[model samples]
Target: MTSTLQPVTALTLDLDDTLWPVRPTLIAAEKVLAEWLRANAPSTAQNTPPAAMLALRAEVAAEHPHWAHDLSAIRLETIRRALRKHGDDPALAELAFDVFFEARHAVTLYDDVLPGLERLASRYPLIAVSNGNAELHRVGLERFFAGSVSARLHGVAKPDPSIFQAACAAAKAPPHRVLHLGDDLDTDVAGALAAGLHAGWICRPDGAHADAAPRAGAHRFATLLDVADALGV
Candidate 1:
């Protein structure tokens, strides 16, 4: 297949829904977190149901705009606040977060992801660029990436050119020489294009955004394997 790309030297990838079904992973993590809270902090668990916890998290995020890029901080504060409100020890928030984080890493990747990463990684330096707190090492995919640049570490999130620039720097390649592949149109495609990198939209068939239209000048693919094929890797 013909590629709408420049001579690509390095690649930046978005995590979350790009590699795995993030909603299921998140739901599972929330369940694990709720179970942990019930066992260790019954008061907080009793008062904070799933909906209440979601509201608390939203409230925490709204109160701390500076922490927009730090999902971990927002979640931790939300847990702390919930614990405090229910007369539970706020210190348990750390343990609760650990349980949630551990569960978050238990992601079942799309079938094409492993082979696609192998093919692409053989020819290009892969840099993970994401707004999430997922650790590649924890996900057992660290060896496929040259490095990672996350919103938590960079103090900026996607659609912001700075984080994209940081990913390019991590790959040791110019923006124009790097191709970024992701699922989100605005944060990944438009973001990479805005940062002068080629953008590839991974629109999996079962994805929630499967029907979303591709942006002008963006390459669209059904899977990571399609990306490797388009790149002739």
Candidate 2:
């Protein structure tokens, strides 16, 4: 165990880029959505390309600031807007979103994730805390987690202390006794610190924050295996 690290009774983990490379997963899911749209809503598909769909999603998000924490809502609205703009049935958004969501859950986890999660889960009650809509059960990783706290369900996202507190509550641990691990510096490390929880920043080589220097009062690691080793799990 690292002497410098604080003792924690439970752990909160980030999903997307921490356990898996989210870009590829999202890209593949978008492709699946496009294909489904072409088959079911040909007019909408013909009118909206991938770039246009992204713009539509952004436009919807800007129009609905209150729904910022709910990505699923934004995505569904985007699909509906596309269908409506193209003279297609907006109700088909539900089925289109379902297709996209299923593809989104088809993630390829990092090599270190399984072993690291096994080690950590054996030692601590792991709670998934995510801003994304990826479901643990769909991702086939629910068994490793005691519970999950999501922005959609909680009405707040990370960088807001409430979500982290919710995760701590789910673990039945006080903020001081709950360590939160994630890849994003702002949402994960700083957010956990702000919430009075220990922070572990897992900076994978290919991550956006990979070149970031270590911050004071936050643990930095290259992989989940490194985090497990540091925690002596």
Candidate 3:
């Protein structure tokens, strides 16, 4: 028996891997940040190996478990600690973090993303909902979205219904009317389904999420264009 699908009035999208490949973006951003560090803070740069920077992140996470949901806080604290220990001025950590943040937003969108977003945004109120720290204004996609919700500001990450609900609220729509798309099955699909939003799993070209098990009500698509086709929007 087929059930009539609910109409999609709005959308809540994941930022990191759905629109752009986040790993490469981060790797590029890290390289640019390292270059800045080498030029401006050589003492800290000499002592802080890339791996040690990761270790500092872990240390910050351990000491401040409450900040687990805020990536900016964790990264900033890690930078501050590194600057302090390496005899660099700790006050400069804020500036260093800003440098890295600017680089982080230099994302290359997937070929289909911009056109697809334009098409979808014309029909529905598109909401950018993410657990990551990407700012749409920085990414230059702020004009396409009606609103945004983030884990950092909300104090809860995805796979928790609170964030999903918050995204729905941002859209000024009920959960059942908003379709949510993301790359992570657990966070995006499971979280949206649990919160009663329409869920779509975006499996990127890398085939990284091939092992995901099917959820009863979820839609699986390769791109945002496919999402429009699937929804008949």
Candidate 4:
């Protein structure tokens, strides 16, 4: 007998690399943000190119080992330190954040995203869980997600149960009735499954590369359309 589609009341989705392609979009967004910062916030822009920011991130990782668990805090501290190192110009720092925020909203969703989300949203509450900044849900994705919890606000990230619990709490769904989807096995899939939610993997290739298996057991789809179909939405 064919299994019936379980009634899912909520969805907890991972942001980066799941709903949208991460590397190219982020890299392009960063480039745009850098140019904007250079024009509007020269002081902060002078020293912090992408490479510099990455290196500082590495240094920050070593300095505060605990931050690896919650990267949002690490991101905040990194921005603050970078601002201080650049003569502590608060206005310029604000401009930098503004630039980055605008660029982030400029993202292009996967072709399947809008339709898939619309179909899912018609039936269930949808929320996003990410290790990114708390503003992830507020940045023009309001049409899709009904709620969100990020590592910034929760003080914990994926692979840890707190973030997922918070998302389920926000959606008022028991873990078993919620479907959580993401691109990471160790973090998103494994973590959500461990927390009792059904988990799936969105495994689209960004460029020329491909992810190898070991992503079995989890439902896998190359596009959100496939996911929507799998859910019988």
Candidate 5:
């Protein structure tokens, strides 16, 4: 039951944990932000910094059930409002946002990032789809991708299919011709396959995903460079 695989004309990537390690970056940024908050908004910082920041985010998100899809807005508004209350000055609100924005831009890309992106971008249109803050792709990684989609813009997260569909549409490519690369098996592999795109799982260097046999038709690459090689371009 062998079949000829179609050439990849488009490539969609996940930002967090795929091209760059996001969780650790977020943790590091949170630490910095917590210190800043403690200095600027000491009273509220106790409940708004570090883990408390994430907890408040969840609590506020639960209040707006209709806004689960656009958590960035919720988060931004939450931070802004919390800072306003603590500082008693609207100007401090902007400072809080600036701190977060700067911290986010400090994310470290993986070792295989530039070479792989250069190789693939030279051949096909490259796009990014991530369920993170929209700004992370737009203002953050704008130089890397030709186009992008985030839950903040699409109003839905991955594993939901619509976001992937939207990314393909933005790239002007059919799902079958697009190769989706990401770290999460369910969000990237299953979701892309469900939406009819080729899926490539970006496992860790330790080969943790070697045993994960996705039921859907998919391929696994240890790094972005391997993915570039897989396409044979």
Candidate 6:
């Protein structure tokens, strides 16, 4: 006889690399944001090119450790600093960040993500837990999640047990009843395990690269579809 598995009360999901590839998404958003700056804030654009803009973000991060977990604030500050350096109105920073933020939501989900998440959502309440600033509502994925706990709001990022614990709380489940899915072994798997939750490593689709095995017990999923199957959702 096939053994039946217990259903998890809730799921804590990682947003960035788990739902979609984040690097290219950010790069594309940056390009559009730079174009906007060049058109409206010329001097600021001249003062902070793409490379220097990255440097400015790091500088701002170092100057305000409190804002380190708040990516939106860091980007806004970076723009404000750049505009102020170029003798532009610092208030324009919000407009500039809005440009980037809008572009940031223009993401292409991995083929398996949508269908898989939908299936999982039917079986369990999903809670978003991420260090990234990606807003699920903006990305049109909020419908699948019951709640969200972000680094910016919590004042801490993952690899720290607090964020994971916060997600479990949001999902109305204890840590042991929640399963966390993420692309990074260290941030997702190890962190979830450390927080006394089950962890699952979401392997990339191409199978070109494999991460190191997580220290604690965990599951490996080729796609979010595999995750649903494994969980019997």
| Top candidate by TM-score | 1
Estimate the Cα RMSD of every predicted model relative to the unseen true structure.
0.9, 0.9, 1.8, 3.0, 2.9, 2.0
Worst 10 residues of 5 by lDDT: 1-10
Estimate the lDDT of model 2: 0.93
Estimate every model's Cα lDDT from 0 to 1: 0.95, 0.93, 0.87, 0.74, 0.76, 0.88
For residues 1-233, could you state the per-residue lDDT of candidate 3 as single tens digits?
A: 01324567889999998999889899988888778888988998988988999998899999998887899999899999999999989998899999999999999999889888988888889998888899999999999999999999999999899999988998999998888999888899989999999888888666577676767788878888887676665
User: Candidate 2, 85: how far from true, in Å?
Assistant: 0.7
Candidate 3: which stretches are off by over 4 Å? 1-4
Mind giving the per-residue lDDT tens digits that candidate 4 earns over 34-66?
787677657767889888888777888889987
Give residue 191's error in model 3 in angstroms: 0.7
Worst 10 residues of 4 by lDDT: 207-216
Query: Which residue runs of candidate 5 sit more than 4 Å off their true CA positions?
Result: 1-5, 47-49, 84-91, 134-141, 207-215
- Residue pairs clashing, model 2: none
Highest lDDT: which candidate?
A: 1
Residues 158-207, model 1: lDDT tens digits: 99999999999999999988999999999999999999999999999999
**Alpha-carbon lDDT of model 4:** 0.74
TM-score of 6: 0.94
TM-score of each model, in listed order: 0.98, 0.98, 0.95, 0.83, 0.86, 0.94
Please identify model 4 stretches exceeding 4 Å from their true place.
1-7, 40-48, 64-91, 134-139, 205-209, 214-216
